[model samples]
Target: MSVLVVGASAAGLTTAEALRRKGFRGALTVLGAEYHPPYDRPPLSKQFLSGDWDEARTRLRPDNLLAALDAEFVLGDPAVSLSDHTVHTAAGRSLTADHVVIATGLQPRRLPGPPLEGVHVLRTLDDAAALRNALAADKRGGVVVVGDGVLGAEIAATVRKLGIAVTLAGPQAALMEAQLGAVVGGLLGELHAAEGVELRLGAAVEQLEGVDGWVSGVRLVGGEVLPADVVVVALGAVPATGWLEGSGLTLENGVVCDEYCRAADGVYAAGDVARWRHEDRLVRLENRTNATEQALCVAANIMGEHQPYRPVPYFWTDQFGTKLQVHGRPSADLTIAEGTIGERFVAHYRDAGRIVGVLGWNAPKQTRTHRMHLISGEGHR
Candidate 1:
């Protein structure tokens, strides 16, 4: 039997590797759109952009490990269309496989702004490299980040470390107010401010002004302009599901899948592209941990070992010399801080008297304990 997997990122590579490890000896093919091999993305905004790690050092698997899978790799060619049993690539190649895995993750959401030379987005290795080079070229210029999301925050922090004046502007009153809440968001804003990043919270970009065909500054809705030599638009990413339009799978925000990540018979999807059945709702998680975990489950189910793919949603972010990790569901109301809220602490989020989430600020060991509570609760459900 032949198995075909589209996308060669964390989800795609992990699913293909898991299939081989789980004893799938049939023909396997992995298709990727990028010219480079699959690499870790979390570091793109951190160490890679900071020049602490090189491109070759970011590969997910070594050459020897990838060779063990013995799968045919079609790099730099994306699967443009898919039928029930057939996959068509942009390079004029049609592949028919016994089973098809759709792991196409996400694409950066482009903003409706002026096209300037210095305006960039971070979603690929090439993107990080370009932004990094731009920052290094003008070490003293101001960098305006258009989004206050985690990616934008990280980029702002890292760029600040490179001696560039960074202006982080977003519509929210605080950075990542939806995910971190007011308390944590305030703390993070303080951290960024302490690091010399100019915060333009509650500010909306009206238009991007350019100087000589290159981005020069960002004009706010109130006619205030933040001088900038470069602009990083980290608005967010959308599920890369445009290619699956003609496919028979249900696409509601993401590929609607069952609890097993199965979109249809003999077909499956994992990662940010798959919004599987969650507790009382369908949710799509776009984190690295979920990608690996869900892909393994997809691999298992593809080999006839059926198991529900319900994850307790975990995510982490590193910014301004502080690392924060979160597990479980977060609600608007968190009762109190289970631990201290200083350099190290575990904030407990409760919903209706039950702890729904645990957030750790530099406390890994303590955070793991509360994370187990979530794991046990999930197992019982």
Candidate 2:
């Protein structure tokens, strides 16, 4: 059997490796639009932007490791179409396969503003490299980040480390509302303030003003103008599934898949590009843990072994020298409370007297223990 994996991101690469580990001796081909190999993205906004790591150093696997898997690597070519059992590439190439995996991941969401020359989004390696170069040259200017999401907060912290002023503006009341609760958000607000970073929550940007085709400042919706020499738009990302339009697969926000990551017969989807059923709801996760687990599920199912993708989704972010790790999904009605254990802590999120999720800050051991309980269905409340 032949397997065609579209995308060379974490999910795609992990799926290919998992398939080989499962003894799939068939023809395996990995197609990637990026000229470079798959690399870790979590560090791009942190160490990479701070000049602490290079592209080659952040790679998920060395070149020889991929070659040892005996998988055909198609770099710099994007899969433009998937019809029947054939995958069509943008470079006018076609590959027929028995099973196809779509792991295209996501693309940064762009804002409608003036042609600001110094504005960028942190998603790809190119984005990180550009911002790193710009910040290294001008370490005394103000950087206005337009989103308070995980990426936005990380970038703000990174810029502040370079002795640059950063103004973080977002529509939400706090950073990562989807992951961190309001109380934690308040704590983070205080944390940023103490770090000499400016926070403008519940603020909307009207437009980006440029001087000589370069960004100068941002005009707020309330008519307040903030001067900024550099602007980074960290307004999250959308699934990169435009190529699968009209492919007869359910596409609601992302490629819809079953519990096994199967979108259709002989076709599977994973990573940020996939939305599957979990806890009686359709969820799409954009995290490393989900990507790796879902890829493994797809790999197992493709190898004639069925494995359900029931993951207690976990993710982490390092910012301002604090490591925030989260496990499981917290409901809006969940009872949330914070507890500290001498610099190591846990935020318990309970739903109807059961612990549904746990957020750990510098508490890896407790996080792992709680994660096991969550997975075993014994930690609710």
Candidate 3:
């Protein structure tokens, strides 16, 4: 049996490796749109953008590992279509496979503004490199970030580290409303303010103004202008499923899949590109842990073994020298237990006397123990 995996990001690579590890000797091909090798993306905004790490250090699989798997890699080629067990690339090439996995992650959403110079988005290596070059050239410029999500906050933090003045403007009332709750969001605002970054919450940007083909500032919806020398739009990502429009596969916000990551008979979807049913809920997760777990489940199910993908949805972010680790989904009716112990602390979320989520800050061991209890179906003690 031959397998073809599309989009060589975290999901694609993980599925390929899992299939090989599961003793599948069939021909395996990985198609990636990016010219560079598959690299870790979480650090792209932190270490790589800050010039603390090189591209080689951020790579997920080394060159030797690719060779060891003996997998064929078609870098810089994007799968434009999948029909009748054949994958069509934009380069007018077609690869046939018995089973196909769509792992085409997502692309960074762009703001509706003039294509001015110095406007950046952090998603791929090229984006990070370009932003890094711009920052290294003039670290004293006024930087404006147009999103208040985790990526935007991290980018703002990194820009502040380079001795640059940063102003973060977003439509959300606080930072990371989707991840951190209202209280934590306010806390993040305080943290950024303490770090000398300006916060412009509840502000809507109408347009990006530029002078002599360079970004000068951003015009807000209320006719206010915030001056900026470098504009970074850290808006979130949209799934890269545009090519699968007429592919007869179920595509909502992402590719709809079953518990086994199977979309159809011989096709599967994983990672950010997949939205699957988990217990009583349908979720689309964009975390590394979800990608890895879904890939393993998809590989096993493809090899005629049934394995359901039940992930707790883990994600972490490093900012202001603090590590924020989250496990599982925090319930809306959760009771909060927050305390500080020395330099380590935790904020536990409990729903109906059962711990559903835990957010750890500077508490690695405690987070691990919480993760263990949550995974083991244990309630808060």
Candidate 4:
């Protein structure tokens, strides 16, 4: 059997690897929109943007391991459309396979305006490099990061570490309040403030003030202007599904799929591009770990193993030497299961009095143990 995986990033590469490891000795082709090999993306905001790690260090696998897989890699050619089992690329190549996997990932959302210099969105390696260059070029001007999500917070932390002034602006009451609740998110805001990052939360960004087609500052809705030479827009992303418009797939937010990650007969999707049925709801996860985990489930289903992909959503973030790990969905009903909120704690999140999530702030070991409470249906003691 021949398999065609459209996307050369972590999800696509991991799907190919999982297939080979599961005894699939078939013709495999991994099509990529980018020229570079599969690389880790989380570090793009921290280590890569800060210049602490080189390009080579971000690679997910070495040359030898990739060669061992023996999968044909078609790089620099993006899939433009899909018709049945055949995929048409931007370079006008039609590739057919018994099974086609869509893992095209996401595209960064940009502000409504013409493209301006010194303004960036951190989604690709090139985006990180461009933002890094813009920051290193001048330490004199401040940087206003629009968006208080995980990406925006990390970028602000990294930019501040580079001795550049950073102002984090967003509509949320606290940093990542929508994800981690007000208490933990407020603590995170305190952490950033302690590190010299100016927090301008609870306000929406109105527009970008620019000079000579270069970003000069970010204007807020309430007439507050945060002046800066560099601006990073981490306003989140949408699934890269423009090419799949006429492909007959139910595209709403992402590629809709069954519980098994199957979009149709002999066709599937993984990673951020996949919004599959899990339990009673359709869910789409946009984290590196989910990319690999969902790809593995897709590969198993492709091999006729027939299993539903139900995963407890988990993600982590690192900034200012502190690592925060979140297991399951964090809700408002939070309880301090261990340690103190001031420093090193594992907080439990409940929904209608049932333990549903766990948040570890510099408490990895305790978090792992508390995670079992979420998995085994046990209440937090």
Candidate 5:
């Protein structure tokens, strides 16, 4: 049997490696859009952007491990389309496989305008390298970030750490409002303020003003403009599902799959590109942990094991001297058990006398224990 894995990130690499480890001696192939080998992306915003870690240090799998697997790698050639059993790449290669795993992840969303110099979105390795170069070459002006999500906040924090003036503006009432909620969000606001980065909460970007053909500032909705030499639009991302269009697979927000990550007969999907069925709803997640977990599950299922891919979403963010880790989905109505704010703490989210979610701000050990509770389907003690 042959398996073709597309998108060569953590998800694709994990799926292929798990298949090999699980004793599948089939012909394996990996197709990646990026020319580089599989690498960890989370660091692209932190260590890579900050110049603490070089490109080689960010690789997810070492050359020794990847060489042992003996899987054929087709880098810099993105899969353009797919059919019943064949994946067509832009490099004019048609790969016929018994099973196809779509793990193409996502691409960063950009602002509505022609590509301007100094405008960046931190998603790919090239993006991080480019932005880093731009920041180094021109260190005279401030940066205006136009998103309040985790990516935006991280970028704001990273630039500020470089002694660069930064202004974080977003449409949310508070920073990271969608993930951390208002209370924690407010705490993060305080953290960034303490770091000397300006915050423009509850605002939207109207236009990106350019001077001399380069991005110079961001104009807000209420007629306020924040001057900037660099503009990083950290607006989330969309799944790279355009290649699957008209491929006869159910494509909603992502490639819709069964509980076992199966899209069709002999075809499976995992990672950000696969939105599996979940209790009368399609649960599509963009978390890095979810990608690896789902890909491993998909590999097992492909090898004749029947298991559902239900994941307790896990995500973390490091910004402004605080590392926040969250496990499971925390509902706004869940009873909160607060330990401490802006310091070592654990905030437990409970429902009906049972812990549903766990949030840790610097309390890694305790929060991990609580995280295991969600994984084992047990309530908080």
Candidate 6:
């Protein structure tokens, strides 16, 4: 029962580890596009981007731990296509196995503009290093971040800490409104503003302005130009499924899979790339926690445990020295479960009178305790 994982990142690596932990002694191979060993991405926007941590510190696991798994890691060669249980890499390597897992993750969306020098997107380790160098090189220049979601807000916060003037422009009314809701998102907006990040909310970016092939500023739809030396586009990302095109696998927003995380007879998917049926709907989660959790479920099912992949969604973000943790889906209907918005607090999100989400604002201990509310069904209605 040989297994082939087509990504060496968190999801792919976790799947291989879980397989070994579950006593599966089959051939295991982990492939990656990046030459660097599997590294954590969440830090790319904060610690890695700000140079607080070096590249080695961002690695998910040390060399000794990875060696214990005893899996063949094919790095720097990306999977270009998949035919049945065999995957063809760009390096002209054909790898076949009894089971193939797709955990290719996502590719960041870029803005439609000139290929300017200072325009950037944060996705991989290389992208982070490039952006970090650009930010550090420009001592007197400001940055214009063109997204209001979690990634954009985090980048702006991280860049501002470097003493670089940051202008956060986005179509959303508040920062992370789509994920954290308007009220809490607005509170986050205030936090950014208080920390000297200029907010340009409710504005559409028309295009990028450049001089001599270098980004000079960002032009909004209404002809307002936000001057900047560097522009970071954090619009969002789509699943990396271009390689799976015509692979006979259903690809919508991601690799479509069943409740068992199986896309076909011998093919499975996990992490950001796998959009599987959850209850009545198909859902794809893009967080690190979901990546590991879904991979474990996939590995167990492959080992014949046959368990369904059902998990309470969880994600956390740290910005400006404040840590925000969210459990379940955040919504517009929120109640102050503990403390006040000005200080540490936990908020419950309700939908149709049922508590559907929990959010902790700098209150990790209380947040963990309140998370049981969702698990124990104590706040269902």
lDDT (C-alpha, whole model) for all candidates:
0.88, 0.85, 0.85, 0.93, 0.89, 0.94
Tens digit per residue, CA lDDT, model 4, 1-381:
999999999999999999999999999999999999998899999999999999999999999999999999999999999999999999999999999999999999999987788888999898888888888886566899999999999999999898888999999999999788999999999999999999999999999988899888899998989998888999999999999998999999999999999999999999999999987789999898899999999999989999888888889999898899998888999999999896999999998889888999999999999899877866432
**TM-score of model 5 vs. true structure:** 0.96
* Model 3 misplacement above 4 A: 139-141, 332-338, 341-343, 378-381
Against the true structure, whose lDDT is highest?
Answer: 6
Q: Candidate 3: which pairs clash?
A: none
Each model's TM-score, in the order given? 0.97, 0.95, 0.95, 0.98, 0.96, 0.98
* Backbone clash numbers for all candidates listed: 0, 5, 0, 0, 0, 0
Ranking by lDDT: 6, 4, 5, 1, 2, 3
Candidate 2 lDDT trough over 10 residues, lowest sum: 333-342
Model 6 residue 230 CA deviation in Å = 0.6
Stretches > 4 Å off in candidate 5? 334-338, 351-354, 376-381
lDDT of 2 by residue, 219-244 (tens): 88898888888899988899988888
- Better by lDDT, candidate 3 or 2: 2
lDDT of 2 at 219: 86
lDDT of 3 at 187: 71
